[model samples]
Target: MIKSGISQIGGKYRLKNILIDNTPYHEYFLSLFCGSCVYELNKKKANHYECFNDKNPEIANYFIVIKKFFKEFEERRKKGPYTIISRYLYDLLNAGILTPDDMIEQAIQFHYKIKLSFASQLKFRGLIPETTSKKQFITQAKKDFKEAAKNRNRTEGHFKNSLGKTTRPISNNDCGILTPLNPKLEKRLKYVIIEALDFRDLYNRFYRSYYIKKGLTKEVFIYADEPYPGTEKYYGNLFKPEDHQDLIEICLNSPFNIMLSTGGECGIYLDALGDAGWFIKEVYTRYSTNANNQNLTKEYICMNYDIGKVHKMVMDNQPNIMNYVEG
Candidate 1:
């Protein structure tokens, strides 16, 4: 499967199989909030029209550059010396002091900020430990290893020598490997339609342009993975509480088959969707990094149609369009 180099917190990449397995029959698929697009890139698509939309301009531009200007981008990166971007450059980019003259450079800078920044978050909180210079990190690692070895020798029993087990330094030159410049990814995005617009506008535009006007009578599915409530601060763009409420209302009223994912504990969202007759499926997920080792959490998938009926749609080999009605 083709992979997206972009990393996003709370991305649906890990849950791709669970989602694909549960998804109903559809001829057209729309990703309303396609951050990182990890799920889209990894999942299989057969004879289906796919549209990936995100409100962030940087993200939309990144995909566009990959799809169209990839040949020039590859040549430029290969010719230029590999120098790590500094925190000052990051600040300048944010301040608009070092705005690039072209979209390729803009994509380069954007990828750098995401890969080198802490947690791969778009917002610049701080540089990762791996951003440190190679020589300095190696020297520090040696000193720490010696001290840890001495302490391990002094200790006893099952835990003895557990420290300094890793010979590699915490900070290294691994960031270069994470560059979002893969040719495979460029091929994957060759035919994808990317858009940077408000979520509501995207929904309305695609519904009219692709479904209604095109006379597509088959079932159309929209996969919405909006930023979970209370985690809006992590995104460069915001999804306010009112926006969440609006999304619920829109999804509830839309004729398209909808599957929306959000935090399992968000009571406001769960309560609203439940009262609106939406089916909520809870799944357990884990995070291996960060969060003070509190790794396990629940994610809820709210769907407009019963997944049990999904097999019928496939078996009957007929269009099972949803009929939206007012309560």
Candidate 2:
């Protein structure tokens, strides 16, 4: 299992298996709106061409730099802000103080922001703390700031000193920028095509041009994990209701295989996809907003092809959605 390394709101880190089991056979895979790329990172890459995309500039830049310049990213992470001061750096990056030319530096700041932000959210109001109260959190934040200013590397020692005989081991999730790099994750991402494009544009770019136009629609699979209906605010309120209709229309009319995952809280998905002859399955998943917040919910997986039939067809080595197109 490969880790995404950064935490993101509405990420599918915990729902990897459920999503995988529902996906049909494909030679090409596209993860549109690939937040944290939890599915792409964990999926079997052998004999598959995978593309990871996100419209969010910061999130996409993280993948762009990490995929091509992972060595430099790890080198800079060692000296980057690992404490509460990361919030200041995040602000600077958003303010355009870090020139656009320095993408790797910007990627480092975005990484810290997501990891350190409240509940691992990009637009967070406060810092994440193991303790519940505001007073304790503020006190710790101040100490962390001082440590970061005094010596960047000393932040690790500061955390150790603060722990002071506590049995709880230091974790990267708790330490933000101090999170170690996973070589396996880097290797997995090496061949993945990274794109920062709107969902519609992305679909036309690869899904239509490369596969549909080439008469290879059945060989490609697109998975969309768009921000759920009520939770659009967390994603900067970009995916509007009209966009949902547009996506549904695309999937309904397309010859290629497409699957969508949602939290099952929205009525539009059930009403639209269900009425359009798509297969909708309810899968159990547990979502954790933070260490203390966990909720078990049903995820609705909507797909054009039936997974059971697809699997049987794949097993028989016959011409089907996995390989052959219907005349």
lDDT against the true structure, each candidate: 0.73, 0.73
Candidate 1 residues 1-327, lDDT tens each?
A: 466766777778768777776677777778999888877775555246778998889889988988999888766654543245466766776678877779988776777677655556645544544333445656887888777766665444543564535755464454653344667788788778888888999898877976678766336788899888877767644566668888887887788888889993488879988998999999988853452343778899888888887642232233434423432
Off by over 4 Å in 2: 46-48, 82-101, 123-174, 289-292, 312-327
Give candidate 2's error at residue 223 in angstroms: 0.4
Residue 289 lDDT in candidate 2: 56
How many clashing residue pairs, candidate 2? Answer: 0
What candidate 1 gets wrong by more than 4 Å, as runs, is 46-48, 78-82, 122-171, 176-181, 214-218, 288-294, 311-327
Estimated TM-score for each candidate: 0.75, 0.77
Candidate that would win on TM-score: 2
Name the lDDT value of residue 163 in candidate 1.
Answer: 57
